[model samples]
Every structure is written in C-alpha cells, then in structure tokens.
Target: MRSIKPTHLRRRAFPRYLSTTTSAQPHIVPITSLLIANRGEIALRIHKTAERLGIKTTTLYTDPDASSQHASCSPHSVGLGAADGYLDGERIVKLAKQHGIQALHPGYGFLSENSAFAKRCEQEGVVFIGPPAQAMADMGDKARSKEIMTEAGVPCVPGYHGGEQGEAELLEHAKLIQFPVLLKSVRGGGGKGMRIVMEEGEFLQQLKSARAEARASFGEGGEVMLVEKYIVRPRHVEVQVFADKHGNCVALGERDCSVQRRHQKILEESPAPDLDNVTRLELWEKARTAALAVGYVGAGTVEFIFDKDTGDFYFMEMNTRLQVEHPVSEMVTGTDLVEWQFRVAAGERLPLTQKEIIERIQERGAAIEARIYAENPERGFLPDSGKLVHLRTPRVSEDIRIDAGFVEGDTVTEAYDGMIAKLIVRGQDRETAIRRMELALRDYEVVGLSTNIEFLKRLCRSPAFIAGDVETGFIEKWKEELFDPVVVNPEVFVQAALGVFTSHITKDAEPHGESLGFGTNSSERRFLFKSLDVLDPKGGEEVEVSITQKGNNLFDARILRKDEKAQVFENLVSSSAFAAGKTGLTTFFPHTRIETTVIEDPNNDNKLTVFQTGAKTELSLISPAWYERALGLKELRASVAAPMPCKILKNEVKEGDRVTKGAPLVVIESMKMETVIRSPQDGVIKKLAHKEGDKCKAGTILVVFEEEEGAATAR
Candidate 1:
C-alpha cells in the first residue's frame, strides 16, 4: 500500500452536458472532481454516483483501510493516517488544495453537520456539496428550527422551544401537558440528548442530565424544550426531499425507520407499511413545503413521528444532509440522490417537479433496506471490533443493492460507527422485497466479527414486523420471544458438534494414518474435551451444557439446567457420513470435519483458515459458541443481574424484601438509559449485590434469594 495523498487522486470536474435539448436552465457548475471526506459505504456510494455522472471521485483512507472496497473503486485514492485528522477542516482543506479538488462531499457523518467546516470549505475556494452554512445553522438550532416549522404550518410537537425557561416553567408545562413528555434539546435530532420522563417528579433531574448530554454531544446545550405529547407506539417516518439552487424542490417518498434501538434506527424501509394514501400525500406535500420554506437545497430529510393510534403525525426535525438509510428511498424513487446533489450544487434545476415525483412514486414503488452492522445485539447491542476474516456478500441484481465499506480481512474498529454494509432490496411489492432481503442476508456471511445478522433475520420475519406494527419499543417488547437461542433444533446441534469434532480430528490425525481412535471395536479412546462456560453478557448466569459424540457423524447434547428452568426440555442430534467409505470414514469423519469449519482466523482480521491436522487449544472458536448458547438461554432466571456495568442509581429492594416475580428491584443507569432489573421469581431478598453508587456489569450478580426447603436448587 503506497502513501498517496488526496490531491494525487482527486477526480477532475466534468463539464455540464452540452446544451440539453430541454428548456431547463444549465446547472450551476459542471461538477468534475469530487473529494468524499468520509470513508466506508457512504464514501463508496458517493463515488459510484459521481462516477456515473462523468464526475471524478477523490477518496481518503486510513493506513489500515488502504485496500478497502471503496478505495479500490475510485480512479484515484489517497491513503491518510487515521490520527492525521480526517475530520479536521484544515486537513481536508490541505487535501483539497493538494489534489486540486474543486468540491468536497462530507458524506453523512463526522464533518457533515459542521457549519464551520462547510464555511471553511467555502472560504478555501472549495464548494461544499451541501446546503448553505446559514441554512444548517438556522435549522441546527432547535428553538429556531421549531419556530420555522411551526410558521410553515407543519404541526410541531407542542412543548417549550422558547429560548429560556426555568425548571419550574418546564415542570409546569409538563404538568399541563401531563406526564410522559419528551425533554429534548433544541439541537437534538437523534435519540441522543433526549429523555422520556414518565412522571413529573423526574422532570428536573432528567432535564439536567439531558442538558449535560446535549452540551457534550453538541456544543452550547440550548434551552431544554418540552414536547407535551409523546407517542408510546410512535413510528419514525421521514420524507426524502431534494432541492436545487433554482428553487425547484421535490419529495422522493417516505421511509419507515421505526425499527430503532436507543433512538437510533437499525432497519429502515421505503413506502411505510399501512400508510394511508391520504397521509402519504399529506406527508409528501408537507415535506416539500418544509424544504421550500427553509430554502433547503441538495438532499435532505424532513422527519416526522407518526402515531398509529390516532393516524396523526408531527414534524420531528429536518436532517440537512444525506441520511444513513438513503438507499431505500433511492431504490423506490429510481432517482440517484447523490447525483442530484451534484447537479443541484452545479446550479441545475431539480430534474423533476413535486407533482411529477408523486406520479413517478405511484408507478415505481416498494423497496426496503437493512443496515448490516458489526454489532452484537445479544450483548446490549454494543459496537464490536475485529477484522473481516471472510466476507461474502450476495450479488446485486436489479432488485438487490449492497453498499459496503470494508473488504475481506478489513478491520472494523470501535473508533468509527458499527455499520459495515447497507443491504437494500427492491420489489414491486413489500413482501417480495422483504423475502428477497432475507435471502440476501442468509447468503451474506461475515465470519470473523460478531454482527446483528441473526437479529435482522429474526426482525424481518417477526409477525409484528410483517404486520407493520413496528414502533420504537418493538425490540424491547419482543426481545424475549425473538432471542431464545437456547432451544436450537436437535439437528443443528448435532451438525455443529460433528463439525467441531471432525475439525479436531483432521488437525490432529497423522497424514497417512487412517483413524486416531473410534475405529472398529474401538472403545475408551482418549480425547481431550475442553468444556466451555457460556454466560450471558448482561446477566452473569451460566447454563449447563452436556455434549457427547460417538464416531464422526453422531453426537448428542443436553442442557443440565436452563436459566429459566422449565419442564425438562431435551434435544437430539442426527448426521449422515459425507465420505461414504470405510477408508474415508476412518480417515476423516464427516460430522467433526464440518462442525469445525474455520470461517475465519481468530487473530488475523485478514486470514481465514480451518483446522486441518495439528489440533491446538484455541479459545476464540469455542468461546463465541459458548456465548451463542448462553444467548440461546431464553428463559430469565429467578434472579436478576445488571444488564451492563452501571451505577445503581436507585434501589427498589431491601434486605428481606418480599417481592413477586417480575417485580422491579433496582434501576441501573448505563450509557444514560435507566434499565430496571426485575425479580425473576417471587422470593425474599437474601442478599444485595451493590449499593446505590456501586457499579456493575451485565451479568453482575445484583441480588440473591433463599429458596424453599423442598425446592430443587439450580444445578
């Protein structure tokens, strides 16, 4: 990997299409070369669109990412050090100058929302392919943005957006609106810097915390505004709107981003399910009006919170840049938003009108997108770090599109966002699109790192999800039912065990030897069995696992005790020999061989090697399996543990506390969200794990209880 600077790889700006036969005015500038100031899928997405328009693309990469898919795609790519400040305006300006880059595209994150950065680009004689800094500044202010939305006839959520209001005033407003109001920062858009207070007593406390978080997340935490009406089952629906310098604005369509965790969307799809035609028209019309009112240009999203109970919606906020889930909108609209951004910046009129866009949506409709992230949902959805040992993505046809950042062996660090790829699938109808996406996800496998692929599969097939009854609380409500991994079908366990065993023998057996053991009339064969303890990350409870294997393709396992012990739940295993001969069977047992298929090399993010002969003790392979089995333990224990390491904010239990099963015992704070640890069984508190200020991790033993004399103890 040579060290190439952004200047050397800068794409030249293409002149506008010469004298279009149409009467539409010429674009502002012929966008020739564009420097994408971000990395990964977004950078690649921008590069592809820019290239298609005859525009050259400039991309920068950290040393480790020099060989990324996006980097290789660009005609010219520069390698920059991660510590060299890719997000810094000075560094970007320097690159632009060196590359002779005419414009800068701040993909989606990092410097995308930085008004000063955009202003710097303007001052440095570089075009920032986004909205004017002033527009971003105005909309960036929560109070001012709300004022604009309210003035424009968009139903803004009622609450305090006023500049200054005391805690008492906010409390009074809360009281008037009733409890369960949303305490939000004026500049808050994402789930961050926001809190949902269910009671009046928690108002001031939550307000302070929200303000502190806001100040940390966005400089100058503005007045803490209150939105009186908070929808419990709210759907996040946003309209993608694009405007040009000529004042021509159009709304592409709506995307249902209701599938979210901690206020951040995970899975997003276009053509919101069950959205009434009347509401759809109204939403598009309102989105167009909002964009026009703000003088917004380029690609932006007008977000709204839709309530299923009342069929009413309120404008949430306007994202003044490309959204993370724009692919879904693009698939349905048949419009390339990135290309439009270039043309709009080039001073071209919006290629389509609002009416025309509506007609087009009616014709070409239905698409869905799922964000594939290198995250572990079973572990409180924490970000994961590792290399892409073996990356295999499904091929994209007309209906499937995959936008990824890294390639095989690429490292996914915690320093950046968890997203690895965007899986977008399109169909004439929603069912076809979803089914196609499921197939793609199954085929798409990344072995080395932990991801939410399994979770996404479950979400897509969820009855509630299929019915479009999705809300922000969907994950919470159905998590228990959706995440019971303990009860895997007997056949899967048998296959997995055999795979493991076969892998072990292949590695240890002599090159010419027929069998290590388990041959004709063979018994008492000596084999090392490394027992793994699989514990839940959130709760430190461990499940008992029993694995027994005979020959290559035969195995059986049992759960000694489930966390939530029910009637003796049992499992059986079955397998068929693959080699089909005595010599082959003795040499390489099919089950053990397949069970131990090395999807990835645990250490090298780049290399994926399987166990062949010299069997060595490795923890990585078995540990994840252990954890996955722990994850399978669906039933909650009679005891409660901390979901994550967090300070015990408040305790609802005391020594000798008589509580029923499911009773809330303590409220633990982690990453700002307060999760209440509930009692799994009706029992008296025999012991307390921590005090109010004591911190504990997920699986931390928080409390214990003494069982009845005749009751069987957890074995």
Candidate 2:
C-alpha cells in the first residue's frame, strides 16, 4: 500500500442532485438532503455513505467538537453546542427547516431511541430515518419488547418486564429468577440504569439503586426494572435486519459482539467464529422473523445471547437504530445500510432478496472491528480525556477501514463518550483478519493521552480468542493476562523497552547530553520514571528500565542489581519484561509499587539513573481532566457533593437535622445512575443547596453541615 497522508484522502465536495432517475429494476430512491443528529465515528460512517450515494449531508456538533472530523465530513455542517443547541429539539427542527433538510438520521445514541423525538420529526414534515415511532416505543421499553418477542414465539430470557419498578417487586422477581439476575432499566441502553445482583442478599439494595438510576435517566420513576436471567458462558451476537415500506424484510448477516465490559460491546466481528452452518442459518432466520413480526422498517438490530455449551440462544434486546459497529457488517456484506435506510424511508422496496444477500456475503470476506477509546486500562479502564498531540494511521486498503471523528490536537472531554476511533480489518478468513488487525494496530499510533491500544493488542493474540472460545466474560476471564504489563512476554517487553529507549536517546544524542547532560554527577543527578515495573524477588524493588539507545536493533540499558549493579541486554529488542511473578498485576496504579526492569546492553560513558535508593520513583501520567473528582477528594467533608452533571432526585435531610457519617444526604442522578450523596462527616445540617429536582454538578454543594458546639472539627 502506498503511504498517503490523511489530507490526500480528502474527498471532493459533493454537488446537489440536479434531478432524479427512474428505472424499472427497483430503482433506489436517492436521498436528496440528510441531517446527521449525532457525533463521533458512527456519524462519520453515515456521512461516508451519504457522500457515496450523492446525497447532501448535514452534520452537527457541540462547542468542544466544533472542529471534529464529523463536522468536516460534509460540506454543510452546523455547530450545535449542547448548551447552545443539538439536544434542543426546537433548534434542530429550525435548522432542518432552514437548510431544507428532507430527512433526519439519529445515528445510534442520543435522540435515536427517543420516540418523542421521532414523532416530532414526523410532525414537522421531516422523515425520521429509522424504525417507526410506534416500533421504537415498543422495543425501546425492555418490558414491552420482551412481551412482543414472547408473543411472536421468540424465546425470551425469563424476567418481569411489567408493572411499576419497586425494590419489593424486583427483589421478589429476582429471587424467583434465582441468584445472579440482571436488574435493567426499562427505558435506556448502554448499560446505564443497569446493575448485576450476584446473590439474593444484594438484591433489594441493588434493585433500589437501579430503579433510582432508571428514574433519574428516563424521567419516569417507579420499579420499571427487567428482572431477567443472567446467562453464563454467553456469547453476544446480533443480526442486522432491514425492512422496506413494501412489507419486504431481509437479514444482512450476524455480528459477534461477545467481547464486552460492564455489559457493553467493545469488540465486534462478522461471521462469528466457531459457528456451524446450521446455527448460523438459524440465527439469520430468527432475526428475519423478529423484524417481520414487529413490522419493522429501516435499519434495526435484533440482539441475542448464545450459550456456547447448549447452543441455546435467547433474545436480549432490540436496538431500534443503527449500531456503532454496523461498519463491520457493511464491510463483509458489500452494502451501505445507511443509504438503504433512506431508500426505505422514501417508500422504496428492498433492492435484493435473502438469497442475494447470502450470496453477497460470500463474495466478500470476513471483517472484525475493535473500538479504540480514550481510557486507562491499568486504572479500572477509567476514561482518559486530553488533547491528542500526535495521531497517525497507516494506509487504508480494501481490507482496512478506520472510522473516526477526532484528529490530532483535538481535546477529548469528559462530557461525551470516550471513544476516539475504530480499528477495522478485513481478511479472506478469520485468521488472516486477526493477523491483519494486529498489523493495523501496530502501525496505528496516537499520543498525548492514555488508551486501551496495548490492551486490545493483547486481546487480539490471546489463545482463547485465537481459538474461537470467546464469550461475554472474555475480558473478565483474561483481565489479569490482558492487562498487567509487568507480567508481559519477556521478548515483547525487551523489544518495547528497547524501542522507547533508543528513540529517546537518538533524539537527544547531540548536546542536550544523556540524562540532561548530567554525566556521572551522581550527587546532582536524581532520576524518576513510571515504566511498568517488576517487584524485586530478593526483598529489593524490581524494575523495567527505560532504554536510551537503540544500538544495532537492540536496547542499551543498565538493569539494576541488588548491590546497585548493572547488566546489559543487546539485540533482543522485542523481549517482554513481564514474566512469571509472585503477585498478580494490580488494577490500581496509585497503589502499585512496580519498578522498572532494565538491563545493561551497551557500555555507557554517561551516568544513568535506573534505580534510586534501592527503589523506583512513581510516575503517574494520564489525562487528569477525565479523572473522577470523587476519587481524588478523600478528605473530610460534612456532606457529599454531586459526582457529575446531574439533577437532584430527592433530598433525604432537611436543614437543622442531625446526620451521621455515611448517611444518605441527597440522591444525585447522572446519565441515569442514582448515586446517593452521603455525608462524609457527622454533624447537623446547616443548609440545603438543592431541593427535589435541582440541577447540579460535581462541585455543586448539596448540603452544608455545622460541627457540634462542644466537639472539635473532624480535621
């Protein structure tokens, strides 16, 4: 592949259609003008399809995302800062009216599942490019969707998808479903308002919490939880099915979304690995049936969870809009689902039959997609937000596709999803696809923020994944092996350490001097670093050394010794430092006391600070903007503060009321999760900043406390 800069790939501006063509062979109705109501990679993907179909596209973004790639995808773009516009239905409608936008496509999240939004679009004379409002309303609700599926002869996970949400009712239902039930919100997706109860003892507490979250997020309170059976050793797979206005529906294919975390899809692939022909065809038929049963139109996904052992699959949930991983299905199927969504919206019939769709998948190849997010894998996968300094992706081939909405120098904020881009690869087969993905990952690089790139690489090469023995618990099962770089392959560690060391040394070889020109000045030289470290076996701290020079493809560094000794490793650049060790790699980085593992490769004339006083200095570097403030504020406080941008649910205490530490103060909800604001200190409530439904943020004080007259301050 030729090395072409991203600028060279810039598409020519599209012109508005002068006229429409009519043919006898089910001529596809071309969408004239479209407005994308979401931001990020998915929006970018939809833009590409709209561009290819000669459809005029309009993209919207927030203030922080004004310069986002999605904004640049089309010629006509608008900046709708969340505070200024975007979510404001009236502003969006006004913009559409001004631009003469014929259709509105809610790409996946945000307003996609909002039935009222869809209805409003219909009322304002703009086509909603998704399932019908009635269909969305039915499927968007967990309980209603389950009832529909059950009536249609589709196997549903046993659950209580009915009545008002309550702790008493949900707990009773959970007891019937047995231990390890999933308490889900009836109104939302993306794992929000969802919680897993591992045992009966935690049912009531978790149920109450889940309901509070659902109420806060969806604006409808009560016990509207779906008490369902939690399937173990489950594989998350969904079928992409599309229907037209003429009552014809077809299933494109299936996508394996088994790789997940906290019940959210992270990695996805087409033609799920290890499935037999019978099972494969069965899934597709089931999807087709589900779509036809609901009289579904536009693009929709029928999700299901399969039991690897029994091969029993149960309906999970139906996403009423386009999915984030729809690109994978598109790559393998050789069809643009988004354009079809528009065609159907325009009252067109499906262009192809089920047989034709099946033949199409065979003509192309298998595809896999891995989502790259701005998160720290070592720190509980906490979201990392910061300005991206250097971003680069290798050449894109027929087999390689990248979907992104951010560029280098763009700041990732905490107010939105942490996704940066998607690394998608296609191959003649699964093995080839896996290998191509590995190469693509290595060639792809992003600097200035923490990400899960390394973690994904480890996952791509894992034995279970390679052998097609993956399930929903894949990440959890391989948590220790996937992360914890200290136990990395000796060869990989050696190579990475060498590469980083040599790059730095090569850059600073001239007069900046090795170690800031502090040559052999042991007294004046103090060094500190935060490389993935290894604990010392002989009561000494173990460390992974940062290499400074790449001599003949080998790392040249000094490995610290027990008696302050140094050793060298030469030519072995790919060796890993994380080998077998006593303790497992800890998830918390702050508490981890790992030392850098280094070895002397070249005889150094300059003094290097690999070890300091028989210990390694801690290096904690990450996007500080995304770090949770609550995790940082461990000091004394009379009352708890809001965790994020949210509204007050209900205050439990009144002014002048006495409360003990850890007692519930005010319930603040954000993104649907009801986080009970608790008192950090024992004192009498002096003031209440918020009432039953007040909007607040992380620093927004909920309540104030006064110390007892005779008691000293807790501090």
> Candidate 1 at residue 518, lDDT?
51
Off by over 4 Å in 2: 1-29, 83-85, 215-217, 221-223, 487-528, 532-565, 569-715
Please give the range of 10 consecutive residues that has the lowest summed lDDT in model 2. 580-589
Per-model TM-score on C-alpha atoms: 0.73, 0.73
- CA-only RMSD, every prediction: 11.0, 12.2
List, residue by residue over 1-715, the lDDT tens digit for candidate 2. Answer: 0111222233433212111232433444456899999887878888888888888899998887777788788888988866335567678877898889988888888788888889889999888899888998888877888778778777777777778455676678778888788888778677777888899987887777776666645665434678887877889989998887766777888999999875667889998998766666666666776776776788999998787766678888899998888889988888778878878888887777777777788877789999998876654555566677556665788889888878876877656767898888888888899989877786655655567776787788898898888899898898777754433222333332343343334444422112434454321111222233223222213333434434333334444423555554543333323221111111111233223333221222121212211221222211122122213333334444554556788888989888887788887654334557677667898889888888764456777777454332221
**1-715 in candidate 1: lDDT tens per residue?**
0111222333443212112233556445787988998888889889888888888888888765666777788878777777335666788878998899999999987678777888889899898999988888777776787788888888876666664468887788788777788888776755667888998778888887677666645566543564556777788999998877766666788999999876788889889998766577677777877887777778988998877665678887888899888988888878888888887888877787665666677776688889887766775675555777666688889889988888876877545566898989898788888888777777665656667877888887888888888887889989876675432222232223334444444455421111235554542222112221122323432333344555444444443334454222122233433221101112223343323233324453222222222111112222443444445543333455665446787788898978886797887665434456677666788778788978775467888776654322221
Prediction-by-prediction clash tally: 35, 43
lDDT of 2 at 434: 92
Q: After superposition, how far is residue 615 of candidate 2 from its true place, in Å?
A: 25
Cα shift from native, residue 372, model 1 (Å): 1.4
